[model samples]
Target: MTTERAYHHGDLRRAILAAALDVIAAEGPTALSLRDLARRAGVSHAAPAHHFKDRAGLLTAIAVEGYGLLAATLQKAESLRDLGLQYVRFAAAHPAHFQVMFRPELLRPDDPELLAARERTRNQLHTAVEGYSDDPAIGVMAAWSMAHGFATLLLSHNLDGLLDGRDPEEAFLSLTNEMFQSAKNPATG
Candidate 1:
């Protein structure tokens, strides 16, 4: 067997999670089944349950992982604009994680790891946005809305013709630059 397959077969938690992510990415979270994940992971039907109590617990784990990844991604940004770009890139790259991370109703709201991971990502965004405005909260909201909204649009194909064959990230940079320029010149804004 390949090394990666061997590792998954040896690590049930990771195996189940990997299978769950695949199912979620292919058919959305509602289609995920612990039993199916266990079968795919080469474990007993109850194996996934031992690690994640139920579908919500499994989803909470996914959310925690997603937020941790997002925190790491955002932490690497040198500027607010870079942070926004990273946020969009992250969502585009991890659509399954992105889908689960925002759906609070589908996860265990009290999961400590999930809460901490979410806070870490949020704090990173807040810190990045604070440099641009006196009210960091508002800046954070605006920046996150723009980036997340843009990502959603791109993922849903809502921005189809608007892209005009331009790469998504390049288009985002161009749009952000225009917005910044407009903000600098009120008459144009």
Candidate 2:
């Protein structure tokens, strides 16, 4: 029953986004609603509409922010393996954002901000794979697919008992090394 007046003093856009992330983490993205976000932010339902037009807009904003955060994290990584590790860590740290960032059907994929942010993230990935293999594009794709698949598995708890009691990071590093080693020695079938 709070009013828009409650949001008069601060950045309502960021507040609404934080509420959306909380809701997404607790109930999944399908449960997100501007009205629910407004309730969590202690504002009128229409307040979120002013900031995010609708649910797709809100999810688009989240995707943009997620990509920017991912780009920053990847930029700080020192190597391809470190970049992969950072990708997994980012997913673990921001599951809500990670969930929405890759689901294009749930976001406004044509949004300029979202597109730019995605490109920045892709550039970071490409940079990580540059000079690591004969075909940089394929190398980038392979590294991205492996990191994304691993992060998704971890997020879904599929790696719980499969890790055999080893720490997740240690297990991930082992898997990453195994992948690279196998790439260096293709098997004949």
Task: Give the number of the best model, judged by TM-score.
Answer: 2
Q: List the residue pairs that clash in candidate 2.
A: none
lDDT of 2 by residue, 67-105 (tens): 988888887788899999999889999999999999999
lDDT of 2: 0.88
The TM-score of candidate 1 is: 0.91
Runs of candidate 1 with Cα error greater than 4 angstroms are 1-10
- Name model 2 segments beyond 4 Å from true: 1-6, 187-189
Tens-digit per-residue lDDT, 70-180, candidate 1 = 887887788888888999999998999998999999999988898889888888888788769888888989899999999989987899899989899999999899889
TM-score of every candidate relative to the true structure: 0.91, 0.93
Q: How many Å off is the CA of 2 in candidate 2? A: 9.5
What total of clashing residue pairs does each candidate reach? 0, 0
Where's the lowest-lDDT run of ten residues in candidate 2? 1-10
TM-score of 2: 0.93
